[model samples]
Target: MLSPRRLAATAALLAALTAGVLALLVTAGLITFGAAAVTVAFLVTLAALAFLVLIVRRLDGKAHRIDLRIKKYEAELARTTTALKNIETRLDLLVQAVEDSAARRADDLGAILASLGEDRVNAMARAREVEELRAEVRALARDSV
Candidate 1:
């Protein structure tokens, strides 16, 4: 668990120290120069492989987090879509009720107007009958006199 930068620095220091030791061994005739070179190459390659693995693991972790967020957003979107559909259904019902109520009110108003017209005609007929009766009474009085 060292951070990447710390691990890299440590690897570099170790490599340098290792090369110095190998050079001293070669000068003192304890090891061949080719053997020292091969050893250094192997260590450097191993360190590079370790660094690559760490990078891959970190990227995988970030990708997992992003996937989780995407799933959460998709769920929220689904819920919102369902709620909007419910609202649309309620709105349609309300509009229908208002239209029906308006039609009923118009019908009632038409009936009231028809009733008033009939009342006016009946009043006119009654006035004519009363005038005829008064004229008949006056004629009878004249004949008797």
Candidate 2:
């Protein structure tokens, strides 16, 4: 749970303490200077390794979190793609329906125009017959007079 900086700082502190103790032991004739120097070197190396491991672990954790986020985004993208496809299908169906309705309306309009043309022809014929009857009636009146 400790941050990398805090972990490294703790490791450095511990290494320093160990070096100090070794130096004290050498001064008190408990160990030789050459042996203490070697021991201090070894302790410093261990501390450095510990710091590196902590950094690597922190980076690995961050990579894990980023991987999770990428997976979530991919899932959302897939869902959006599916929704768009569904909308496109519905739009196509609606367009087809409109085309069919327009075709039906056009056919109905053609039928109405044909009926009107027939009615016009019938009216013209009736008007001609009425004119002929009027001329015959005038001729009969003249003959009587």
The true-structure Cα RMSD of candidate 2 reads 2.2
Compared to the true structure, candidate 1 yields what TM-score?
Answer: 0.74
Best by lDDT: 1
lDDT of 2 by residue, 3-106 (tens): 76787687778778887899799999999999998987887787778778877998999999999999999999999999999999999999999999999999
Worst 10 residues of 1 by lDDT: 1-10
> Which residue runs of candidate 1 sit more than 4 Å off their true CA positions?
123-145
lDDT tens string, model 1, 3-121? Answer: 88898898889888998999999999999989988988898898889889999999998999999999999999999999999999999999999999999999998999888988889
TM-score of each: 0.74, 0.84
Deviation (Å) of 93 in candidate 2 = 0.4
